[model samples]
Target: MSDFDIKSFLTTLTQRAGVYRMYAADDELLYVGKAKNLKNRVSSYFRARGLNAKTVALVSHIHHIEVTVTASEAEALLLEQTLIKQHRPQYNILLKDDKSYPYLHLSDHNYPLLAYRRGKKRKSGRYFGPYPNATAVRESLNYLQRLFLLRNCEDSYFNHRSRPCLQYEIKRCSAPCVGHISQQGYDDSVRQATLFLQGKAAELLRELQQTMMAASEALEFERAAALRDQIELLRQIQEKQFVDSGQGEADVWAMTDWQNVLCIHRLVFRQGRLLASKNYYPRNPAGDDDTELLAGFIAQFYLADHAQEGVPKEVVAELPAETMEPITEALRLSIGRRVSHSRGQRGQNRKWLVMAQENARTGAQAQVSGRQESARKLEEVKQLLHLSDAPARIECFDISHAQGEATYASCVVYGAEGLMKDRYRRFSIRDVAAGDDYAALEQATRRHLTRLKEQDDLPGLLLIDGGKGQVARVAEVLEELAISTVALFGISKGETRKSGWEFLWEAGAATPIMPEAHNEGFRLLQWVRDEAHRFAITGHRKARAKSRSQSDLESLEGVGPKRRKELLLYFGSLRNMRGAPKEELEKVPGISKKLAEQIFIQLHGE
Candidate 1:
């Protein structure tokens, strides 16, 4: 633990009311909190009397503390939520969820129909369930269309129907837009569909069964069979329900708080089937109680889901009754549901809440472990490279060519966890001779150093794939660019062209420093050196292939683009074109006798 000034840091806080954040030396966010009296709450950290274990530990890492004065406690809470999502402070309760939830998109055409989609609202269609998974939502949609006999065809197809399509003949669609069914009958089907999505499955099923029995007594066999099918479809839909609370389409979300972290898991039910589940971990969560944190996550989580019409009919949480009403109304308006929150602790309803909580715990633990592992690997790399600080950013350069022909260079980057491919670059040699290794190296070094000078962010290390020569060239380039601070090294293969045995080049040294056998430094240099070589060789191969293709064409005389392209397409390459006899040359579409002779002479040198 470093010496942190607790009293000095706490003096700025006010009991009046505000939000505050604590940060570590590396700028990692430690925690975010809001209090009625900002000064009083913040002062607790500096107490001569013992503080809670969590507070004591957090205070030890406090190099800097920042604050924002809010007008009221509610304002502070809102700002705190925004910061938690943004910073993901380590010591705060985090809600980890990133998957896009499914939504039922209701098209805004004259006939307004239902469809399933996910993501930000792009078109003017009402979207629903970012269902638990695509499978459940898809099956529900199929059954709904079957039971309601609503048309599934697009508006374009609906408009062009002079006669009924197969959907009508098969009894799956009423075809209202094409006049196959009366407006009143179509409206009834639409109403039934809307009710099913609203979670009134029992009512819809009961009505369909009654209709079927009534039709049978009248001896209308054809109509009776159709009604029976609709009833069966409704029953099938009901069978897929994992937990039916006698309520309709809705989402049940639960959260678990542990080790100052929060995990929020949600299950989406649409058309009586559990459609999908999503888990979110928001960093730096805080509340007066567990219920408050859950309430905060729901509000922030659903606001994004609402615009897409994915809001549920009911939301069940372990939170107290006081917080449920506003959350329910907010969600209800988003997806047009009469949203309700349940607090039943002793039934099948209670089991759903527990299951959701379990999922949250498992998800949060896994995410935290992954983050720790990444951090450890980064630490390992830093120690091995003898870096003054952690190498959060690395730059590797390599040269590629075939005996110096088509020589090109590639620069690649890696940081904290792995490679940053977006920052990778490839350069064509501009001032280097073919087959001249030193000259090609010089050209690449100069261009890369010049660009690095103009860029704001610079790499922590400059890795070259050759021995002392390569390292010295890069150092010279850096010096010329007026940049003298970069840590430069060149890695060259040993006598047998095998790895593990390498030469390390540094500035002002006549010889490279070769590490002892099985040393950590050797392993570190090998990793970076191999990475640079791979990048350079890949670039060189591509350049060489392109040059070989165009050069063959360049050597041919009296052949323009049109004729040369004809020759290439006809014979494939110069070797094939030269092998072709007089008759084969005559068969080419654009080839004249003189032009063919010229090509033959260029190829055969006859």
Candidate 2:
């Protein structure tokens, strides 16, 4: 809760539209909502009732407020979700713990390929899942790989496999690229894999088991052993099967609010077994009803990783009647399945739904407890900056380099009282002459400023990690860009460049806000400065690696300008090239077999 008294501030409907944010003491943006009347909508929060005890606690923390007027409520909602996802405020129900969802990726090739993947979907392929967790999707992929036997090897490696790989010797693969298996056998394997993913795992397993028994009876021991292994693996997976319910894939989501926080838990049953269970905690759901929060959480959660496979035939969630159709239609199109939500009626199924709700309650409580330290640190920052309003969103910058080579700048943000690491950004010192610190600083600042102008949101405060010189430099950049109303400052080193004596750089003089032995403000700035330094150093390391790769390519003889690029693109990097044999190198567009052999010898002395 912010310190700003919602009870005291009166609504004048001062603006037709604007973005309103509700934040807690830790400066963590709890909830961001837009209004048709900026003041009227914001003022309404003071009178809302039935708010959870947790919600009241958060409201108690409000110390300051700021507003950015927009022209539309639609713009406000859009900004709200974006910031919620970006900062992940405490009051909004947020997906928990998982860094990313998993997917089953079918690789690009004439033969095609299948594998389990996570992170950004940059490669060309048909991806599915975003299953409850990585393990569930991975189990599914293992089943498919064993059934399909499609080559999972990288293209270049598969191309160079003159003999059948271990997968072939083990009978899991037909080794089509090396011609050990006929095109027909490979196609049959692909068909079975698809069926297993489409709620036919049990049927597929029975067929595979039967084949194993037949092979053993025919004295094909090796073939039988391979089949036996696949059978055992499949049997061991997804042990929590539902015998009473009709066999089909489905997802069950349940939500509960504790204090002002909401938690959602999902139980995913795929192929009639409980595949995975997950929990999500969303922030500052103050004044928002349970049904609304549940609806919004489900939409954003699914969108975050839409490529996952196995859309449950039904999605069971505890929500109001109105949300059901829109959710069903939206998911149906994305997953190509008939999606529906169910309310628990009695029996074991009803108990499971209760279990999902309990999970949500526990998760929300844990998150609120864990947020304490970060909140205290944020309050300290507010005091140290002497900001007119305590900044709920603060952005800090730092520069790093090794002897001025491969210079880089990093920006890290803290919101509502803690760091939002995902919004962190790194900028390569482009357009700046190498080794020129001032030029690098100027370039990075301008790029950041320009983007901020284009984007609808900006940080509440901007901090640079240096003395007066750095502060002055940033101010000049802002002035040149004609931006006003931005809080800017620099942090200078203390006595002997230690923590305690640091000064805040102001125009014309260095103002001291040195930390006493236990000053909260001093400790807070130290933490921020340290975090910025770490982020900047990490960026500098990455930039140096990229530079080294380019230098390596430039040094290769006969690789010249055009051929160098072709090699890098084909192989991905110099490391890949160094590992490549002559035969692999010959595939690069401009490289002949003779030239490839020369390269192999020159690089490896082979």
Candidate 3:
């Protein structure tokens, strides 16, 4: 147990609140901990006798220790969770949160954009739900499209529309791009949609009634009919809303542990209605008691801000008696607000806890079975693809371009957990033919394959975006690199250019090999391919935007990044820049009359 030096590391431990990590002799992480006093808490392991069996066992393997100081205990709790997630320390209870729920985001604009998001909420907009399933979010979005007719296209797509697209033709959108809907009309629809999301059906219905009556009174029978239809839809939706009494917002948490497996179910309520439930499997959460686990999870969960829409005002949980008050106080300090952490041991709260517990038990068993199934499928992939071993790391590549402009390539990695985002990379095509997809892929492979020259880090499977031709190029690149063990393949869009129907190819193979459509191997390949396309498209869009903006601004003398930004901010857009009067340009604070004239002449191409 004394395999490495732990005594010297303990000498440097600070007295301030922070998190500490202990590593075993093999550099394997043993545990992660947060303490109000690092020196006191950490030293207790080596200095204090009569330690708990778990701490005693963990300290014996602790060949190394690392500490990170924080401003407060609350910050330390967050940092501890983050480190646990990254390292998956054997002696720590880590939350195994794989999926993030989707939210329906309504953009703040003259004509709002409706879309689905599952990442960090960085944009300022109206967001609803951490919906349990993506299908639910999509369903809600579809219903909103039918009732409100808000635009659901990207800003770039919206900006380029010369006329209404299929969404407008099908009556799902008001065609704001073509001026088919007035600003006031679109604004009203956005307001109504917001009210619907907020679960204010009664108020929204009353407002709709007034609007409908006024439309009828003004002899606008068509508009009145439309309003009447919307009202009927709202009533139907109101009937489906959940019945709950938590004063609009509350989060319910309950847990179940079978043997050494632990699962926690979190049911979130917004506007007095159930929005979604999330299940977590904290990594190796076997050693701790229920109270310690609950306290640690509460400190990490609420403070993490992992879910959208911010923290709820109330958290109802089936907590061990000893941990309730301290957990509540910790949450208060973390959020700087009086957040209620109620023990769901009685009344409606108890019922909520019961439901969550039942779900937790079921979910934990299901999660275990799912991991087993995924492992089996990976083995199947190895045999099916004729690989040397089960592929643990699969890398997929794709190239995106608009005709012959703004070429970009993306490399997305798929590991056992699916979509290893941290390993994904994007490459900009320089001095290459944008239309030549094969050459673009070759460049991407050469760049990526060169970096993974080490024996272990190179992917077991190499997936290219296109068929036959792309496969040949990848094979050529792999040959040039003098690497041969990696299994290279390409996925081609079939005759219909659809998902499910895509063709697969092995390196240098002219004929396509077909895996059954329902096979897990096929589905996994499709998932990686689709994700690669998505990544490539996003990078391509950004590259094109940057190139256009830079070329336009850099064409002018003395107009660098800062001045270009200032002019763009003042005028709002390139269109506005072209239209501004010379006098107005001169009044832009930094622009002299001579410079303004030059700007006008350059913009107008005089």
Candidate 4:
């Protein structure tokens, strides 16, 4: 499997903390990792217990490696991420996709407008959050606007407004758009808003009290009354937020997983009260135990922009003591302080940690129950379908095409746990006529049958997403492969157009087996059929798009891929090049005056 001489590389590696990059046979990066000792950490991968199914698959494809030695593990951690960004290795557990978390940006203006923002934060504005979800930010923003009469209008809208808008009429804004509130009054409101968002509500309340008292002494009764109303609103907010946890501020991190899929939940707390909670899902975590996962996650997560407000005073987690020590030191170095990172200590700290753990555990248990429920449905399917063997592994096939173009066949697999996403496959129908479903099924079934190396690998039941005609064709192919043990059935959404009531039939059978809408057996069948249909549509659409993109350039006899690529790169896209004049087209590196005219005519010709 592995062509690379890993043992010889092991001899060459030094016992130093550094980053190591692993490459696959095709010189593709499989994984990039950092370790306390390069030799020991890299050596452990060859050990027996360290190999999981995912890692084994990765290891089998390894070709060669590279190394960059760092002075410390922390530096190595930073370098690992840099290399990951550079290569995006298949085996590494990446931080997150490029989809950025949303935040609440308050503009730095005459009357600062608050709005939900997504993307890189600019330097000028005051941003209050890296909130978990849009709903949370919107809920908090809604209340913040109500409690403090701050402007939520756009800068353009505010600058051009002829009069106060509905926000002012609803008493949500101070009408600063039309100068209803003075600059000084608006500044005071913004200052309080800043304090409240900074998790310093008490400090804001005290400042409001002082302002109200001064207004009263100056005989400004109207101003004092308005301040009193604001103070009451702020107090009402505090009363709602004040928790009875009897603990100090700490950010709690807990992990829960099912069947190798893991989710880490982070709860940010202020004054013993939960401020915000966010969940992070790591696709197929590499750690063998909970401790390793916790330690690695702690290192990677804190190093990123996850902790926007710097590090919390205490880092509460349910990690092992051995795992905690080194991670704690790394965290201290990052935070520029000696942070308390421990778990299951005592009192309210324990209570908070336990609560977070419960959240994680409950989340994990839900995953387990969901899978178990699916398994039960499979069991019901076996009994209802009258099969000799349990239908633990079910395979469904579907055909998708448009009249006479871009025909595709999709095979979706389902196991006892649920949908086996990794085992899904799509085949483009070549020999079969474009709209012929029966011929398409026969061709796709033959391709799938050849891949079955062992009897155990064969599906317990085979389902076709058509009537008896399609089922009969698949059965003929199965007979050609001499695979008779696997049961065969056909599923058709009848003319009723309802989902649950599907007609099921055996191979070459005329009569349809009817199952109730609420039956778990019918539900399981429906799930598999729907997945097959979706997979077929996705494959068909992608194929059709590719055909459209390729045929456009390939239609020109003289325009080879190299020349077409050059022209497209210069023009930016096919659509752009269609309108480009021959003069502009000739500007491309490889195009000639004669060739450019031909391409121009080929594209924009009547």
Candidate 5:
């Protein structure tokens, strides 16, 4: 149906495994996919027969296709996931969940505390178990506290404690805060807990048993009883967890569809114990069958950067052996080890597989029930905004900076489904005076609108994260660009400077529009504005950090690499150089008196 020149394109396609992207006439991304053979997989979409309804619909809009060759199918899979996350093409199945997995963090302290942590790992400590979810991390922390009695209190709280707290009375903590447990004794407990978390439970249990025996032989009855109780708890955990001596680590996956809603359930197993379970509902616009969907999910799941630390030794699924071969090969290429694939025909593997399958079915049914809520909310947004038709797309802009430096403008996109992260963009504010938000907004809007005008793809509504002044500035840009199809509005914090008390300024209006706090449309606007603010802040922080990390002398005129090296060597460090007077700077090789004075004035603001 599309004038894509499929025959000409196929002739030039390669047979190697790689990634392919489809685009519409307007240059909008339609889909991104990986294939074992680029030539064959892409050809399937254009065949005369056997094409599904959704695939045909996608092909009908295809203007052209682009391909990137990779060394292996595994590499292609990784690249495919990265592009999908970045662009989120219309014809591809998109996984909405993006939060990082949680971990059990052990602080680097004399008496360390085991705590649940998420996000970037910047703290100095040992991190273990990038568990499936926060609940798994918390449950593990509770078990460790019960068995080892390690402190879970914050360092500040521990430092200021005057006496044993309620946790000590309840027997969950040994009250390291009150010196009830010696540093050496707490260190031993920490070691045992670490061992258990590292999946060396048998080794830890044996060590605990030996310690208990020694205590009993030394006539330390109380110490022996405590050790014995710990051993019993460990044994109970082993039994209840269904510990299998043979299996070290594995993941079981099951996918099911109910009323066109698809769900994938995953069960993670580490050290023969079930760690946690997760459910994913990806939007499948092309209507891929079970095998294709399962394979895609596997590639995206295991190849993600967050998942690299937790790749298992095996995977259990119901997919055909042929379908799993490439997946196994790709995973091996990614993790530097051969990860076997199992059909889960019998024994414990089969049982885990069955559980995952049932969970997937249940999750799909639940998703079907909740599908209408999103539509209802969208309708409410339409009524609140007084739009004749529900908007297909909404874009918001926000500006962020530290004082007058490292300014960044962020544009976030929201569509019918929700936040469209792939469509988000950040513009570094340049040529404008630092901290001049009006000029920054004008520049960013001019650039963004110029591009949209070329592509003929403009959003229905444009929102600004500021008061009427900001909206007027952007409106001027729109007028300059001769674009008027988009409706413009601005959001500003109310006098209280709190959420749910925000004022909105419609374009060309002298006053702000105050919507009720509980209005769904107002809440949607709040969500988009907050997202834009967050994105801008993140970009600004990264730019600020990078600017700070660079040498201060780089910004000075007439300072090249050779001059910088000479200056550093003469002064030994930047700190010493900054302290140098103009006379002292003049003594450095190739440093003229005038240049030294200039450098001194710039560095010291003298």
Candidate 6:
């Protein structure tokens, strides 16, 4: 047994529906399971009693577990199947074939019947899907039947019908056999249903919108409302079916780094079905860009002797063509076959790429969730700082600005439990010289420390994103406040001004300590520093954008703060206000006809 911290992990585990993956000591995925409540389900394996020999063996080897939350149990089930099929973990009962996968079959009659099917596609006029399961297919079929009123009856039963069936009475079928609907009308319904099945949502929505408008123009309000309802239902379906698509073949590659752990996920599609997926964690010693990493991985992957047999005809990623060109050329030469590389900017390819990216991000997060890695980093921090015990809480501060405008300082909190986002604070630097980072840091630190002092709740260590000068300013703040419990350090970029070459300055120390590039403690510090920088920069940009967005309105004559607020409130946005006609502008409260005309003329430059 690998001493898995079941009790501690369970404390943070959520009671939501999700998929949980169990891993062994070597980071080998052993099992994947879905649960209605993640906390209860995962806890069952570690109970004190009632374990079978196989279950005991599986639990004994468990090192850590990771979870991906879903909105509902159905979604969790679907994602569970996806991960199971992709990884085929040793403890999972793998499906030997795609025979059990369900599909939506549209028959060849005048009023084509949409029905749930499995196994062979011999009787199909069009097979829309190999949906994850029969339930998903049935749900889609039920929705489509309601939206388009397409029939769902056997051919023999349809041919012998003398009048409308119950399905037709319920408005789920158009009853083409009894002439309740014209052939032209039934064909149009079939065409619309086809568009929905094929995942041409945009085109289908456009046609629906046009029909709704026509109905409105003819004063058929009831029909227009019904069309509107149908459109909404179609949109809902689209949101749920983001991964659903028609026939295609390609391989998707995505890479992501989470909590300093890098993961790359590859998804393979054949005949529009997800055949397999796998994850890789290549060492990123040089901290390469994603493009460089992906290019290298793709080249090495396809050039491998065993990989040549499964080389896809097309490869899709979130990389540009120029970056992938060399790899594509190399593949052609080595394999004597042409392979296309795509960015997957739109349609089904984009969806596949997005899914791959999401999986990569989640996989990286899972790897980082392992307690051993986190404990190692914390232990390194304790040794580097010469502390008797590992610090439970560390806070980092950074200042950001554009030349001399929209100055903001950000504080990010980190602890054994990972980032404490709720504890993060942003200070809008005031009464300080613009671009004077020292002043901003002093003000931000004084304010943050004052609050912490009153509450008697302070972090174990404080980090600043600058050198001795910045550290001195913060030290002065601590002295003025008469606070001495927290240790303080400042990190400054080395001469090359790159990551992995930062010099750390202790409070009141003249000399800076430069740790080795690969030190875990230094890496943890870098991650915290980078996070503070990102948060500060993001806050600064939002402040700058808000100032710039209001600049135009502020400059307009007779538009004081109150009037500007009213104009924005009434029009919803500046763009809408600019486009509003004078007559509409006059309708707003407190805007006279003369003022409205003047406003229009100024807005239009007329």
Task: Report lDDT (CA) for all predictions.
Answer: 0.65, 0.64, 0.72, 0.72, 0.76, 0.78
Query: What is the lDDT for 325 in model 4?
Result: 81
lDDT of 6 by residue, 333-377 (tens): 987999998898876687678667766776675565455766777
Worst 10 residues of 1 by lDDT: 365-374
Report how far off residue 77 is in candidate 2 (Å).
41
User: Residue 32 deviation, candidate 6, in Å?
Assistant: 4.4
User: Clashes per prediction?
Assistant: 36, 36, 3, 0, 0, 0
Per-candidate TM-score against the hidden true structure:
0.33, 0.35, 0.37, 0.37, 0.36, 0.62
Which prediction has the highest lDDT against the true structure? 6
TM-score for predicted model 2 compared with the true structure: 0.35
- For 190-242, candidate 3 gives per-residue lDDT tens digits of 98888888888668877877787799899999988888777655543444212
lDDT per residue (tens digit) for residues 64-90 in model 2: 444433323333343444455556766
Identify the superior model by TM-score, candidate 1 or candidate 3.
Answer: 3
The digit string of per-residue lDDT tens for model 4 on 401-504 reads 87868999999997765666668999999977768888888888898887883434888899999887888888888888889888999999888978876899
Poorest stretch of ten by lDDT in candidate 2: 236-245
- Of candidate 4, the 10-residue stretch with the lowest lDDT total is 237-246
Highest TM-score scorer: 6
Ordered from best to worst TM-score, the candidate numbers read 6, 3, 4, 5, 2, 1
lDDT (Cα, tens digit) per residue for candidate 1, span 1-606 = 454544433422334445677778886779988776776888777778788888789888887665544334533454565567656888888866456776776666656666666677776855655554444466678777778887777777778888888877877777776787777777677778877877787678667766766887999888877776665556545542233233456567877753334677776555544334456666642335667777887888777654243666667787787888887777677667576778747444555565566556654433432334334545655666566776556677777888878787888775543445567888888766777777777787777777777885677777777777767767777887778667777778888887667777777688767776455445545665576677777667556657778575664657788887666545445655554444346546788766766765555433
Query: Tens digits of per-residue lDDT for model 5 on 275-343?
Result: 445578887777687889888888888877546338889899998889989888988887799999899
- Residue pairs with backbone atoms closer than 3 Å in model 6 (clashes): none
Point out the higher-scoring one by lDDT: 1 or 4: 4
lDDT of 1: 0.65
